[model samples]
Target: MGVRPPQNDDDEPDTITFGIAALDAHLERADVEFPVDAETLLTQLGDPDIPYDATGSTVALSEAMDKVHIQHFDSEQELLNTLHPVFESYRERAGNSILGQLRALLPF
Candidate 1:
């Protein structure tokens, strides 16, 4: 993870740097680091005691990410064009993985 001075009060003290582990690896391969502090914001995401499910969390996180990414673009059309497929792909794959895990844990 890359470290940098805080941008503003609204920004996390530590940024997750490029989103998630997978994204981090990809960015690292590309010789880039976005430096985001996902840890600081995780509590805001859900209760600690609740068992974490990547599928559900991915959708929620993706939505949150989309909101921010959408604002980054100058045009609404650009935002939609970029986010739509990415959101859909994440939803499908993450949803499938969650379902698979759920099935594996079932007695049946």
Candidate 2:
């Protein structure tokens, strides 16, 4: 999933860049090479606030990255694989909460 775009038209991209099958968006810049450290990724991508589920739940990408024990990732896939369970746990936690249930019902 992706966050809402900036209201200003100048911030919009002209091209349609999306995946056929995906969960969350905003990983990092495409130009960044792999085999990178957490610090480097954090520096390059910034600590973006990303959604964990459709109920408007969110976690800082840096926070999720903290749960990963690895010092460096061989590839983006490896990093994602590592964080998958962490995201799932957060999602499950959110889903199990009473407030999360209400938020899911009413996205306000």
lDDT of 2: 0.64
Ten residues in sequence with the least summed lDDT for candidate 2: 15-24
For residues 1-108, write the lDDT of model 1, one tens digit per residue: 233333556755653322244333433454422233333233333312211123224434444453453434344244335545555565455547867567546543
What is the C-alpha lDDT profile of model 2 across 1-108, one tens digit per residue?
333432445575433222210222455433557888988877777766656665446677778878778879898788777777887788789888998778667634
Looking at candidate 1, the ten consecutive residues that score lowest on lDDT are 47-56
- Native-to-model Cα distance after best TM-score fit, residue 65 in candidate 1, in Å: 7.1
TM-score of candidate 2 to 2 decimals: 0.70
Look at candidate 2 and tell me the lDDT of residue 42: 73
Q: Which candidate leads in TM-score?
A: 2
Candidate 2 clashes: the total is 2
lDDT of 1 at 29: 51
- Clashing residue pairs in all predictions, respectively, total 7, 2
